[model samples]
Target: MIETEAWVLYERSGGSESALDSDDFRRETFAFPGPAGDELLVEPLFGSWEGNMTHSLQRRPIDICKQRGERRVVIGNGSVLRVLRAGADVRGIHEGDVGILHGGHVQDEFGYTVLVQGYDAPGTVGVLAKRTKIAARNFLPLPLESHHRLEQWAAFSVRYLTAWSNYHLALGAYRLQVNEPLDPAPFVLGWGGGSTLAALDLARRAGCRAAMVSGSPQRLAELARMGIVGIDRRAFAGLEFDEGRYASDPEYHAAYRAAERAFLAAVHDWTGGRGAAIVFDYIGAPVFRASVKALGRQGVLATAGWLLGMQTTVNRAIECIGRHVHVHSHYIRRADSPKAMRYAEREGWMPQVSEIYSWEEIGGLARAAAAGRLRSYFPVYRVNPV
Candidate 1:
């Protein structure tokens, strides 16, 4: 006999005298002693339907158990009413709570019984809770190391969204099926600092190389610090542009075009005519066509934001047939996967956070993103330890 520390309550058919021999009465009749040595059992009652009897029994198991002086009670879904009626030593459990009703299945907010330890909120009866597995530990707060590990794991799992989003685009362009090994050479592109770094880290994990085209020197330097090889205007000759001169000259537009052509030529040479697997294309339309034109057999162009403008055209059918290129645009959502956090921690790719700000400084961070002054940037919320 598999003896367990739990109790059941139910009714029997016929009168009280006939109940003992009835199958329904025997099935509904069960008892167990509490840890404090109190015997508990369901009252002798009968009902027309099994469902109704089970429902009633769930609601009153605790009450019936308490009448027997059982303070330490374990109630199943059907016995909620009895537990509520007994109302003896009732205290909710938390995610990391140990002892008491540990390893037991309880209902959450949604009325689903799951193996959850924590109470999400007070006064939430019959509501199911999120399920989490727990290990043996004395009733106490999680250790600092454990807390930090959980935080980092949660962060990385949440931040991996950017990588998965980009990967989706690449997968579609390559006409690859799920579970198929991707040819990493034709599917990786490094764009903005965060996304680029995230993509590069993902590429490394996927066993592929990545190409980065940075508009700012600081960005290139940051990538270098992350051990990502990058190419910029400074690396090549005869492809320089004077920002001041271009801004003032009568033929500024013409000079800009010439400079763009030179830059494109350098890119083409760098790729050895095979073209890039992915292009960041942050400089917008001026370089948009060049980026598309520079794609390898199955390259994807993922744009985070259009800084220049959103107007661009391509011969859809021809572009698809000739270069087999895919275009994808996206912006990061606040909730990302924890893969990103893990990558940041594992690779030490921490964003060179320009400033740490309190909640009051949110406006400043917004202004910086608007003015495009933040470097390798991200806004972090400040919370008190308490």
Candidate 2:
């Protein structure tokens, strides 16, 4: 066994996010066994700072703090790794190869991800350590001749696959309603955090008119530089659809209606009055109402990210058939992994990073992400030397 130092989250922040500052995240020594049974001994290079990490730390929705009766876990979803040794049963991956590590731990019968490694899965350690031994199935080897930096690939790890899957599913749902070829490609509007930008990038590449709604002026400019329309999210400020507030507060109801009107008007103006054919939203509850209302007839609202809040009230009777709006929401499909990696490798679908934090400052990073103060859509952190 080799002694390794890993950042361990011993306690959860519970329901409140302010408790994230507690001394629960600290470094501890660990013993990692040699690779066996399709396992790989790998060294983490760069780890991605998921925007929703605070949700995991807070243990509010999904308590990844412990799994399979094991308390005190090291939680990480994505990282770039350098293979030190590969088990005899491993295929394709070999010693000394560098690759992006995966987190789709277990899939459903139809290849949909039911369990994610290093987050909610049992016995699956994350990539926030100096060294780790993991199953080879979680490894996706990067090309040695790749032009993008290792850290950029680290940005892609689970994120790009997620974005690609979300994008394809949303586009498919749009096709189901529109029933047309890609001749006059649809207008795709993406609004949310990290993964949304990457998905918008995919839309831009596929000959579709792409736009991004972001409160971050820096992000707006970044997407603008890439020729995507940048809609100011601040314009739709009072559009949150809170069930209790809308019911009790008259001002909230008025503000919500006004904001929804402004948002739909903006959407129509941007898309030449046709409205968005697809609105890829992942921010969840806060923007849910405006997003769904902004859709054109038969337009689809695709979502996967739940950074702000998870639960939202949607009326089934109000959203189908004659209403002509579809909500396509799901986690990443297992089939998206390899194909998404190929797109990243061949088409350079790397994320646009804003900040890269150190391992020691990871706790602070989580707080910043929750506060939405990060300058870039894609934020990352270094684990080990590249």
Runs off by more than 4 Å, candidate 2: 13-18, 32-34, 66-68, 181-183, 322-331
Query: What local lDDT score does residue 149 receive in model 2, on the 0 to 100 scale?
Result: 85
RMSD, every candidate, angstroms: 21.6, 2.3
**Local distance difference test, per candidate?**
0.39, 0.76
TM-scores, in order shown? 0.49, 0.92
Task: For residues 1-386, write the lDDT of model 1, one tens digit per residue.
Answer: 11232122223323333111222211122222231112111110100111112222332221322333332222211110001111123234232221111112233464332332212111111101111112222011222333233222222221233445565566565554223344434434554444455556666556555657666777677667666666675533333344455578758657566666766675677666766676665435545656676677656666644444456667787676755555564422222323433445556533344434443343343344434455532333221111
Residues 1-386 of candidate 2: C-alpha lDDT, one tens digit per residue: 77788877665534445455557667788665667868899999998876535566666576666444556676787788999988888888878888877677787788777777677777767787889877787787787688788888888876787888888888877777676654367889978777888888899998889998877787778878898999887997777778788899999999988988888888989888887888888888888877777777778888776767777777776676435455554556755677887777788778766668898887677666555566666678988887
Candidate 2: the clashing residue pairs are: none
Please name the candidate that would achieve the greatest TM-score relative to the true structure. Answer: 2
